[model samples]
Target: MDRLTAETKIAELTKRIERHNRLYYEEDRPEISDQEYDQLVRDLQELEAKFPDLAKEDSPTRRVGGQPLPFFEKVVHKTPMLSLGNAFSEEDLRDFDRRVRQAVGNQTVRYVGELKIDGLAVSLRYDNGVFVQGATRGDGTTGEDITQNLRTIRSIPLRLTRPVSLEVRGEAYMSKGAFERLNKEREEKGEALFANPRNSAAGSLRQLDPKIAASRQLDTFIYGIGELQGETVESHSEGLALLEELGFAVNPERRVFDNIDDVIAFIASWTEKRPSLPYEIDGMVIKVDSYAQQEELGFTAKSPRWAIAYKFPAEEAVTVLEGIEVSVGRTGAVTPTALLKPVSLAGTTVKRASLHNEDIIREKGLLIGDHVVVKKAGDIIPEIIAVLPERRTGDETPFSMPTHCPECGSELVRLEDEVALRCINPMCPALIREGMIHFVSRTAMNIDGLGEKVVAQLFNDGIIHSVADLYYLHQQRDVLLGMERMGEKSVDNLLAAIEASKQNSLERVLFGLGIRLVGAKAARVIAEHFGTMDAIMQASEEEFTQIDEIGPKMAASLVNYFAQPQAKAVIERLKAAGVNMEYKGLRVEAGEDLPFAGKTIVLTGTLSQMSRQEAEEAIARLGGKVTGSVSKKTDLVIAGEKAGSKLEKAEKLGVAVMDEAGFLQVLEGNG
Candidate 1:
C-alpha cells in the first residue's frame, strides 16, 4: 500500500481497535470476538511498521508492551493523594457525617459512596486529552512514574474523547479471575504464589518490564479528579461523570446519597455482597459530593474531613494454634507469630497470624494447640483476635517468651517502655540477616532482584555481611553465579540494580541504615534538613531537636546511632563505594529573608493559576509550613475563589490572609 493509504488505514484501524478495547475492558460489552480484535491490532501494527513515521504515540498497538525501563523516574503529584480516615462501624460513619454537616452548616450534604478497591492507588495525568503520565501514590506528595506500564492496561485510554487536560486518581487492580490464573501460571513454573490479588496488582505495576505488567491483565477504576485544567467540575459525582464521558473506566458501582442513613444502608448491603464482585474491595469510600462542601469541610493534617472509608468487618475463621514462632526484625525486636493450622480467611490461606508480642499472647491466653480465631485486620494482616479457651485440651502447652535470642544465644533484654524483647547484640546473625533484607527493601536502597530470600541466602553463604557489602557485589559476580537460581542474567540485573541504587538520595540510605526511631518520613526530613550524611553524623542531639518534627527521642537516636563505631565504619565503606551521601531533593534553606519562612500557612478554595498542591509546595520551598486548617497557629491563609469556613476561621483568629494574586506575587518574591 502507498504511504498515504497506509496512514489513513492505520488511523482507521487504531480508532476501531481502541473503540473495541473500551467496549470490552471498560464497558464490559465487546462488539468483536477476541480473534477479530487481535486481527485488527495486527493490521494496525503491520501498517504502522510499513509507515513508521505516521505511527502515533497513542496508537492501540503500543498496548502490547514496550522496551524495559532502567528505573521508574520520580514524579511529584500535582495534588497530594491523602489517605482517608477509616470507619469500622455505623457510629463512625455517623460521626463523619456529623462533622461534615457541622462544617458546611445548613447545606444539603450529598455523599458519593464508592467501592474502595483493594489495589494500588495511582494517578493518571493527561495533556490535550492524551495520556501523558501515570504514577504510583508514593508518600502522597511524590510518586514513581509508570507511564509505560500503565499504557499496557487496556481499560486506560491512550486518548480521551475530548481535548482537555486533567489528572485523575484511580485504583489499579487485578480481577480475582486474573489473579487465580496468574498464580496458577506461577505455581506451574515453581514460583512463589502471590499472597492476594492486591499484592499481585501492586507487584505487576512496579515491574520494570512493561511486558510483565501487560501479561497481568491489570485494570483501573478512576474514582476522582486530582486536578482539572481548561475546564471546571462543581462536584465529585459530576467529575466522575465527566471522566466516564471522556472514555475513562469510572466504576459503575458508585452511588450518590443525600443522607448518611442511605449511605449506611448502601454500605450494609455491600457487606454480604462484596464477594460476588470480580475485584476485591476492602471498604467503601464516602465522600461529600459537592466540591464546595468538601472545601468548606476542609482537611485535617493527614486526611480530608469530608470523606471516610468504611472498612468491611474482617473475615474470621477458627484455627488451631499449632505453635508460636519468634523472629527478629532489623531493629532486633523479636516478634512472635502464631503458626496456625491452614484455614481460608479473606480468600487466602491463613497458615500464620501475628502474635505481635509476648504481651499479646498473655492477654489473649493463647497456648500451643489451642483453638483461636484468625481474622485479616483491615483485610490485609492476619491476627488472632480471640482464643477459644473452652475448646483447649489438656495436652495444649503454655507458650512462654524466650529469655535468649533464638539465633545468637544472647540474653534478650526489654528496653524501657518497650514490650518486645530485643537482641541488643549487634553481631546477632538474625539481626544482621533481617537488617540486610531491610537495607535492600523498596522503601530503602531499593535494589531490585535482591528480595528477602536472596538476602537470606547470601547471608547464609557468607557472600555478604553488612549493608555495605551489597555495593561490592559486582566484584563477586562469579560467586553470585555459582549460587542456586542465580544465572548470568539474574546476577547482571541484580548488580545493575545495586549500581543504580547508589545514585539514590541520602534519605533512602538513612532509612536503610535501620536506625531506631527513624522511619522513612523522619529519614527524609532529617536528610533534607542536614543535606549530607557527614552533617547528620556531626549533628548534636540539641541541634537535631531544633528541626520541627524531630523530637528528643528521635534526636537522641540519631545522635547515638552516628556515634557507633560499627555504624561509622559501614557508612565510610558505603561512601568509598560511590554511594550518594547528599540530599538531592528540592529544598531551599529556611532563611529569615524568605517571605514565608518559618510561617504556618493554609490554602483554601480554588486557585485559577495553580493547583492547591502547587501553592503548598511553593510555600514549602520558601521554608513556610503549609498546614491544612486555619487556627491560631496559622501565620497566614491563602484564600482563593469560593473561599469557605477556613477563610472565616482565619478572620476570626486574626490570621493574616492573601488572595490568589497576592499568593502568586509572594511566590515570585515580590509581595
Candidate 2:
C-alpha cells in the first residue's frame, strides 16, 4: 500500500482500537475478548514498527510502556493540586452546601458527587497524544517520577486517540477482592499483611520494580482533568465526557444533583450501596457542578472551599475478644494478642487482634478470659476496643506483662508509658534472625531472592547470624551452592544482590535495624537529622525530639538505642562493611527548575527509573522530601501511573500536581 493508503488504514484502525479501549476500560463492557484486544494492539505495534518515521506519538500503542526508567526524577505541577474539605455528618454536609452557596451567591446549582476512592492519586501527562509520564500526588506541589511504572498499568492509555498535551487526574485503587488475595498471598508466604485495602493499594503502587507493580494488577478511574493544553470544556461534566471520549475510565457511579437535598439523598444511598460494589468507598466527594462557582469558592490553606467530602459510615463489625495471649515478634517484642473465637470481619476470618503492649492490655483491663469488643480501627487493623467486664467470668485471669521474651527467653524490659515489653537483648537468636530478615527486606537492604527459608537455613548453619555475616557468605559459595534448591547461578545472584545492598541509603539502614517504634518514615527522619552514626550516638534526647514525628517515646527509644553497647558495635561493623549510614553519598532528584523543588514528595505506583528508594533519593536530591502518605502539609503531589488514595487526598488538600515527564521537565527546568 502507498503512504496515503497506509495512513488512512492506520487512522481507521486507531479509531477502532480507541472505541474498543473505551468499551473495555471506560465502559466496563468488552465487545471483544482479551485475545482480540491483544491482536488489535499487535496490529498497531506492527504498523508503528513498519512506519517508524510516520508513527504518531498519540498512536494507541504508546500506552504499552517504553524502556524502563533509569530513575523517576521529580515533577512540578503548573497548578497546585488541592484537597477537598471533608464533612463527616449530614450537618457538616449542610454546612458545606451553605458555604458554597454563600461563596457563589446561591444560584441554585448542580453538584458532582463521586465516590471517594481508597487508593493513590496519580497525574497523567500526555504530549501530542502520546502518554509521556505518570506520577503520584506527592505534596500538592511535587511527586516522585513514575512514568515507566504507570506504563505497566494496562488500563491507562499510553497513547491517545488524537494529538493533545493534557494532564488527567485519577484514582489508582486495589479492589477489595485484589487486596484480600494479596494479603492471602502474603500470609501464605509468611510475610506481614497489609492492614487494609488502602495500604495494599499503596504498597503495590510504591513498588520500585515496575514488573512487580504490574504483577499486582492495579486498576484506575479517571475523575478529573488537570491542565489541558488543547480543546475546551465549560463544566466539570464536560471534562468527564471528554475523558470518556479519549478512552479514559471515568467512574460510572457519579451523579449530578440540582439541589443539596438531592445530593444528600445520593450520598445517603451510596453510603449504604457502596459496599455492594467491588471497590471500597470511604466517602462521597461533593463538587460544585458549575466550574464558575468552583473558582469563586477558591481554596483554603489545605482544602478547596468549592468541594467537600461527605464520609460514609465505616464498615464495622463487633466481635468478642475471649482472652489475651502474648505472641513474640522477630524483634522479641511480646505482643499481647486478644484471642477472639474466630469471628468473620473485614471479609476474612479474624482470630485475634493485636493488643500492641502490656500497657494496652492493662489499660483495657484485659483479662485472660474477659469478653472484650474488637474493631478494625480505621477499617484497617483489628483493634481491641474495650474490655467487657460485665461479660467477664469469675474464672477470668488477670493479664500480666511477660518478664522475658517468649521466643528467645531474653529478659523483657519496660519503657515508661509504653505498656509494651521490649526485649533489649541484641544477641537473642530470634532477634538476630528477624533483624537479618529486615535487613534484606525490599524497603531496607533489598536483597533479592533471599527469602525466609534461605535466611533460616543460613541461621541454622551458623553462617549468617548478623547482617555482616551475609557479606562474607560469598566465601562459602561452594557450600551455599550445594544447599537445597540452591544452584551455582542462584548463589551468585544472591551474593550479587547482597553486595549491592551495602550502598543503600542511611534511612534503609535505620529501618533494617528494627528499633522499637522506628518505622520506615522515622528511619528517614533520623538519617537526615543525625547524618552519621557518630552524630546520632552523641545527640541528646531533647535534640532527638525536635525532629518531626519524633515523640518523647521515640526520642527516648533513639537515645536508648544509641546507648546500647551492642548497637554501637554493630554500627561500627556495618560501617566497616561499607553500609551507607549517612546521606552525604546519596543523590536526590534535581528538580531545580521544577515548581515542586524544595518540596515534599510521596511516590505510589511502580516507578520506571530506579527503585522506589532511588526515586525517593532523586526527589531529595532535587531538594524535596519523599513521604509515605498525603496530608494537608504536602505542597505538591506528583501522581504516577497507578496512584490510589493519596492522589485523592492530594486533590482534596488542593496541592499541586504533576506527571512523570512534567516532573522530569520541572526537575530539568524545561516545564
- The prediction achieving the highest lDDT against the true structure is 1
Best by TM-score: 1
Give lDDT per model, in order.
0.89, 0.73
The residue ranges of model 1 lying beyond 4 angstroms of the native Cα positions read: 183-193, 586-592, 667-671
lDDT of 2 by residue, 1-671 (tens): 67787787788888888788777777777899978988987887887787787677667666555554333455666455766776878899888878777655536668888888878899998888778778888756556677766776767887666787888998888888878888899899999887667667766666555666766767898988787766867678888888877877888889888878988998888877876989877788888876655544555656777788776654455566666678656656768777787776654567878878766766677667666666665445777777678775588877677687876787888766665577867677777887888788765666766778899799988877677778778789988987999987678778777776777667778888888789877887777766776777798989888876799988888888888887887788888777776754443333345444667776654445444455665676666776655677777777666665556667878877777766666556631
Q: Which ten residues in a row have the lowest lDDT in candidate 1?
A: 585-594
Q: Using Cα atoms with residue i matched to residue i, what is each candidate's TM-score against the true structure? A: 0.94, 0.64
Candidate 1 per-residue lDDT, tens place, 167-274, comes to 999999999999999999999999999989998999999998999999999999999898888888899999999999999998899999999999999999999899
